[model samples]
Target: MIWSSASAGPTNTLLPAGGCTLLPRATMYAPRMLAAVAQESQQRCRFCTRARAPRSQSAGWREVRRSISSNASPAWHHTRSISTSHLPRAPLAPAEIAPSKRVIFSGIQPTGVPQLGNYLGALQNWVKLQDSQRAQDEMYLSIVGLHALTVPQKAAQLRQEKWDMLAAILAIGIHPDKTVVFFQEDMPQHLELAWILACCTSMGKLNRMTTWKGKLAALQSASESGEATITSSEASSLNLGLFSYPVLQAADILLYKATHVPVGEDQVQHLELARDLAETFNRHHATGQRYFAPPAHLITPTKRVLSLRDATQKMSKSSTDINSRILLTDEPEAIRKKLKGAVTDSERRISFDPEARRGVSNLLRICAALDESRDAHGWAELVNERGGGSGMLKSVTGDVVLAKLEGVQKEIKRIKGDKAYLEKVARDGAARARERAERTMREVREMVGF
Candidate 1:
């Protein structure tokens, strides 16, 4: 009764029994929210197209027949009903359902050595996921060097940055054996799939991306002020890559059939776009099957880490001021100096008001994120209880941050010393990634009639 694709070959096995399972009521409803929105599109939409039937035959059959009859178009009803008749009348209860293995994915751009914000915000989360992952779960963490090409870069500097990034990832506790950590540029299938997805994506969708808009606005400002490296005419053409890189990002996730993506708040939009493209591809190519599952966001606690110099802006490596951020490789003295000089309000009383007192709030957030035992508000209270002003707050926060980074800094230095081992790790990870990517591309090519 299983529907296997003859053209898909043995390696590209489609799920049996129409890929139906008794997922929890909560999990089942999550995809329905996406399906409801997708159905409005003019194109035929079959997102999360599995039928959810109950355990009782009379109730399940009635409900299954009703859903298949109502949700499907007139053209699909005959074929769908014929397929449903072969399925079991009684479905297993949610408690009886086996735990589904997860495919987790997240990537970071190889711009330079990771700063303290990167450590607390993303790298730490990556390590946490690795440590807590289920035995059957698969994890992919990539240094997205390809994504970095959207902006101008010297070849030598870019190469060095990639090396530094690889070291930083390992230093932060991303074990190669536990997680597939690879360079994005090493996998050509990423670009190959990106082109295919780009065709499925619409320009209107790309235009609405806030990150792309922000980059354009920044570029325009730089051009107006005559501070831009490229001429105004060149700037217009150069930015095309920036506008389209999100599609590549989508390819990165969908290529691996990733079910969960760890992303910051700002990157949620990109993840949504990936979901849309997954649905669109299924609608056009997979017939009635759900080929790609929409990835859910694993939003981290430390979503936004602000700059030390300017609380309004995110901590970024691109900033001209070195004091604005603390690098992972910074010595204890350097870390203490930066924390000491971090901008805060003149208020004698400490509070966690991000809007009114961004500087003080930023320091408190750092303390809370590092400690994990308390929140920003708790740290604020502790600072005030001890009658400690900004100086005491800075000193205590610096001590905690240094304590966290001390081990990571030493690990990074040790990892960076062994270039041969780093190369071997990259090669092995890329090989595994390629094996998986190739399996996907084969099915994709067959479905798309390539």
Candidate 2:
């Protein structure tokens, strides 16, 4: 889950690494006091479970609550609900569409690899959600090529990147059949819905968004010299597409009428924006009749996996240093080399102190995330078993990362080899998405008298 940098709290307590549990969605954000806050000021705030949007009648909220009560609760696993939404679009049967089995929507930009943070923070959670799932309640995972264009790109290179990322995601076990997988740019309706939602959105709201602020910060930092200072004018040199991108994101959610959005904590603000827009539009056009229900955040509970070489920074595609990040397609040898070369504190002890030993602690965090059993206890034992040294922790963590990545690499190779099949899948998935998006957009347009 992504939130304010200062606001991030312990995503999981290491009980043992052997087998961590799939926590109930609610528990992900249960008030665990943070040492990061002043001792006297410490308050119980939902850490990892932060959502970008709000909806009182959100189907995702009910599903997530029920998910926790059932999966982690031995007493209530068998209970079922019939109907949760008063909206016309609400899912009909709640019993069969249990949280574990409910439809889910998550997408990523095909802007090459997002570094270790993306993999550990979001992708791993995707695997868990996909694997633990029971029935085939709809799951659509998109490689959003369209989202990529807010920045510049080469057409040929971008196309190849799109295909490559799809294979990579697939290799990571996103079964195209079990989940509807597609390229977002392939659908005309994504843009269509984006336009409809944009009408409801204000320029003022878009201007206040943080995405452009981040870009501006990155630009300023890169250009900073001992004597140079950047101005807001320099920042505003960037254009509208980047600023208004969230409107498109809102459209993505509304187009799917996605009850649940599997979002990292960072995206909660954006999701909240989406919710606000959805509610505003729904209310504005209700004509004393309700339309779309608000979307709910399916907060993912994976640690914000940091850089292997730099604990201070999140692993990112933008990192200038080669060793700072790990790609999903990294070969076992490359993974080993990267881990072996990782930055660790001079201290010998292997512990989870993010404050004192950022580097070593970062490795430990990654190990915990990739822990085969997802058990913190098993991970702790493994760390202790590695002789309680930083080197051993790095070694063990490297092994675990390699092991987890092995299948992903193999699947990527296989999928990449079949370009024709991949294109066919993308085409089919796009068609389906466009159909749904168009349906929603048409309704939205009529509601707005467009």
Where in model 1 is the C-alpha error above 4 Å? 1-99, 218-238, 385-387
Give lDDT tens digits, candidate 1, residues 358-433: 9999999988888878899999888988786898889878888888888988998998999999999999999999
Can you give the TM-score per candidate against the true fold?
0.79, 0.73
Against the reference, the lDDT scores of all candidates come to 0.73, 0.64
Winning model by lDDT = 1
Residue 334, candidate 2: how far off, in angstroms?
Answer: 2.1
lDDT of 2: 0.64
Ten-residue stretch with the least lDDT total in model 2? 1-10
Query: Which 10-residue span in candidate 1 carries the lowest summed lDDT?
Result: 1-10
Question: Candidate 1 lDDT (Cα, whole model)?
Answer: 0.73
